[model samples]
Target: MSALAAARAARAAGRVALTVPQLLAARAAKQPEHVAVTQGSGTLDLAAWQRRTQAVAAGLRAAGIRPGDRVALVYGARDWIAYAAAYTGVLAAGAVAVPLSTRNAAAELDFMLRHSGAAAVLHGPDGVVPAVPIPLVWDPAVVAALPDAEPLPGPGPADPAQILYTSGTTGRPKGVTAVHANLTHGCRLDPPLRRLAHSRQFLHAFPIGTNAGQTMLLNALDAHAGMLATARFAAAHFARLIATHQVGSVFVVPAMAIELLHSGALAEHDTSCVRLFGSTAAALPPAIAAGLAAALPQATIVNYYTSTEAAPTQTSMVFHPDRPGALGKATGGGELRILAVDGTPCPPDTVGEVWLRAAGAARSYHDDPDATRQVFRDGWTRMGDVGRLDADGYLYLADRESDVIKSGADKVSTVAVEAALHEHPDIADAAVLGLPDPVLGSVPAAVLVAARPLTLAEMRAFLTSRLAAHEQPSRLAHVTALPRNAGGKVVKHQLRALFDRPDQEGTP
Candidate 1:
């Protein structure tokens, strides 16, 4: 072959589409009639999905949405099929999608819409449209009825694709902008990799609009297996789906994982079909991982650690008996660093701020350059937590910078305390927080979900061998359950309210 011909072939290959919509189009072309996603009783096939998304795109285009326009998607977890079409349609229309969960309150929806300056909103049937000054479209059925037009040219790899709002545990949520390249990172078209090679269908209950849900959407587009999610997550029902469908792969956040183990949801069900039990949206405590492995002895229990800001760029750790609370090393152009206050790298075994960056386009806070400058520096994204790397490069997280307790002169890791607490058979679930103190500035307090009342003295005795003196909880609250966000992270900000009064457990 001539050099000119070879160069021309390379150029042609490079011009192939690289966006999410393009991935969907490829699937539609390759296996048009294959079922792609299922939510409750609804199922959408690749061919039908392509046609529906095209019609929706035409509707958005006719509604005056142009390239780079921010279109908010207010959808519920139950509307996965509709949301999938609308999301792809937004991309097909060359506009950026801003996914807002139906779980979000009126105030949250209003803030995100106004903040993104959304050109329009495509709301699901159950989704509430805040009274923002933007064009509001009806449910997915309305857009699906619109006549399909010739599909618009796919966006470039670097074109802005979506804005995901962060789960605001410490403060107000910020919109993190991800380009097409970033969204499609690790995805392929030529001989597309069959993720979860052992699974025919993968199950999850992640709420729409969360980073975890977005990854599920990507899975539906390119993964070999179809995706299934329930409208509302319940441990019994989640277990039932696995048993009934003989689901080979499953995923959940740590909160759901704990509920499954503690609630006895899997006791009556035959969950032996689960080949992959993946925990994400937060780190899985080693004890919880061990329990899950015992439940599904055949499955490979895996934990993935990632934040909304540092996604596609994450670390995964297969369940290991030796690595306690370790958030695996980076792979495939992913970078993980422990940086000191001055931004210099910390040596192995030294705790510092965790920073991570993926190979694709960097994500930034939408329309907030000042805030973006703080988190997205150079090409790395600060993880907002302090951790250390082992000589082998495994990351061991200590605590979030805000969650660390300063007991007199000692700095305490709530994660370490919580991990120790998890080992106690009496504690069903637990969270550690720093409560204000006149002398120490702040001290560690524990809120627990247990079968019966447990005293601080008992907890201290049990944890004496597991945690340091400064790390032991001085205050305790026995509650029914911990307050969690849609992403399954503990709402520590609200946990403080528990200590205000006493319950079955003695007063703090």
Candidate 2:
């Protein structure tokens, strides 16, 4: 057996229960003095972090939080340590955690608070206070004042852990309910500090409320080394942190990767310490992946594909020249398949709905049974994305099933068109959508942010070799930026609205 596989098996054999609080307690007991997480100038050792989280849990209990009650966490990225403590504290108190982004506006936050039936809110100083009728607003000071005490009994694996609200792209955001087992999947009772023995530090700039951010938090506890993160993402700042901290592993979304590549900050910093750079949230554009590989010759670039609902069922790929756009094969015991419209398996290279079944426990959307029924069926979850699997089982995503542009009779993938546009040196960002057309019923249109002026004809000429005539965009709009959500995904509905306006035309 492989050494890593053997180690994982050994660790799994020793595990009792897979719960966040138990994992934190295990790490603290095993590696009391190890630095767990660092944000800016502040750092916490495992022992201190555990004590603080327990104290926060006591505080929440004192404030009348009970088992199964939802507690909302609203914190900026810089306040991640507090956020982490509150997240664990909520779970430790046997209450469900509802992590909301500080990027959310008042109305959206209000809606989430009301929808989740949150009893209390734990917020950072800089977080926007929602106008909702939540009972308690606990901040850092309140948590600190609470006497340090052993928390209430840790929740069982089957108990609810957190409610993560999805980024509303197509419609209202749905809360994805995750159990303790779902959150703590793959955690093991192996030697606590063994995971990061060779690795220096793990770094990321994902905001506090994201799935990526929560994963990073888990890494902080379970990984072998210290964890570092920034509250706000600036490419130069992120680059500087990596150089300053000598981070060995880094995680980022594709947008952050693009910004860092263009910022020219890598040239100014000594980044030789970085060995692994990983991208998630969305597929790394093949051109961007190549650029990253060229820029960080010492590092291995990896791409991970998964959704909030179907996590731990990730498809991971280490970048290789032969598989330029492939999102590698499913790993970690997850199963992946492409299904046609008729719900049968699609042949290799045929675009169809992507479905994933996690190796661990299944998940469902909270309070939205209709949405749950639509995506989760039997043991599998529909990823709501359209893609194809290669003969070798590598995944290639086309576009979101809802975002696919229907032009005449041809179903054009917006992501494919955007990928082709991104291949052009002058285009910085791109979003493609289907616009209503009197003659064609619907025609593919593009909105782009470019480094230089571009004409529709120039774009079409460039894409002629890369795409078919029907796949080429029928109209184009130039904008300084494409609308993006907190998760860095393009809001294509907004793009469609922008392009459908009266003044906007086919030529830039």
Candidate 3:
């Protein structure tokens, strides 16, 4: 059947008929020769990618994998095309794909394998598979040689498609179960190939298995652009790739953005081809945003706000000189609400819990009913962020509820303190956490990575004008780097350990 005919049939059958595998098939049918993915010196075309995935699906079926069975994918970003093919193949075989990070230690990997009850493990050449016994283990070469054929009884849109574990910054990571519909929510079947396309190449360095990485993978199939990714992110390497590929659109985290701004790599490359630059994972500080705008004058800098469990219903803001700190209003039929603790709607500029109800967001955690109920209620998901809406409905983030530091009679936002620190010329990166205080219960303390030697007195004087007395850091420590997770968020809990030692406290 033709791609258009299948799409029409699927629409008639309702939403359950459309899935990720079907989307890939549609794109491959329309643009068979288009470059689908580029990594370093390698490239994979659309038709060949589709064919390889089909072969992988056949191999999984021959290995006795069945619908709803979990298959863990272990690979790095450098082998992205092969990983994409494997991910698609798992869906095509009607099995759930669980993508594990290559950075995970043996214990972490073992826990995930046991937690998800994964039936088989598929990995790249260098991937580290856990020692836990599994029925099947297939390397890239093994699956690559399978005969090309579509597997029977593929997954429907309503079927559980993937299991993504959250970054366990606060506690043990929980698995987020996403249906095929959630995965393919915004996919475009007949995406424009000419003038309407955003760019010839979309560049990002998000590792495999992350929500951002998965979103980029879908864009590769549906956004009418080839994807360019790196195994690991280094500011200079990222800038060089953009110039080499003439990449038109790029996505990054705020940490990556800060690195690029300070590394002087932008001056070393011809980055004039970039037209769209986006930041996600966390709010981009206004200082970094302004620097990015100045460096890439032709690009539109966008800040996206969304959580792993509340994806597809995102809030985005295109940088405007007037609203430098706003995260913008909802776009593309998304919904947002700021509500008080009592569930009342907050008035304009009132800080409250941010709730979102995006179409096709994840329904629940994989097997944790208690965790699911805590965040998901009455069709709305609490974003775990404290924010306020402007009179015009633009959202301004204060901080994550878990990160707010209670200092004496006042509650201080770590984000606010960090923003103030970022404004200082010598400070490159900053993280604020609550340290135990005898008088104030918990006081706001800061750790900073500075370009030059900085003293606590200088920091206090610089922040005095910008922050209230209670909001200023009480204790300051100078460090070369701040501890960050795989997703680029500072691990505040890890920083707490620094204060536990008596010798590490106070100004350096």
RMSD values for the candidates in order, in angstroms, are 3.2, 4.0, 2.0
Q: What is the full ranking by lDDT, best candidate first?
A: 1, 3, 2
What is the per-residue lDDT of model 3 for residues 1-508, given as tens digits with 9 covering 90 to 100? 4334556578776643468878878778878999878888888888988898788887888899998999999987677988989998888888999988777767878889999999999998785657888899998788777887854556767889999888888878788888888877766566454321567889999988788988888878877678888888899999999898888899999999999998989879999988989999998988888989999999999999887888766899998879988999876577789999999999999999998886664557888899899888876889999999999999999999999888888989888888888888788899999888888898889988889877667778999899998888878777788888777788888887777667554633
* Weakest 10 consecutive residues of candidate 2 by summed lDDT: 1-10
Q: TM-score of each candidate?
A: 0.95, 0.94, 0.96
Per-residue alpha-carbon lDDT of candidate 2 for residues 305-371, written as tens digits (9 for 90 to 100): 9888987578999999899889988877888999999999999999999999888878899998998
lDDT of 2 at 298: 93
**Candidate 3 has what TM-score?**
0.96
> In candidate 1, residue 172 scores what lDDT?
95
Compared with the true structure, the alpha-carbon lDDT of candidate 2 equals 0.83
- Residue 413 C-alpha lDDT in model 1: 90
Clashes of each: 0, 3, 0
* lDDT of model number 3: 0.84
Looking at model 1, which ten-residue stretch has the lowest summed lDDT?
1-10
> For candidate 1, lDDT tens digit of each residue in 273-319?
88899999777878998998888899999888888998888888888
Model 2: runs farther than 4 Å from truth? Answer: 1-16, 191-198, 500-508
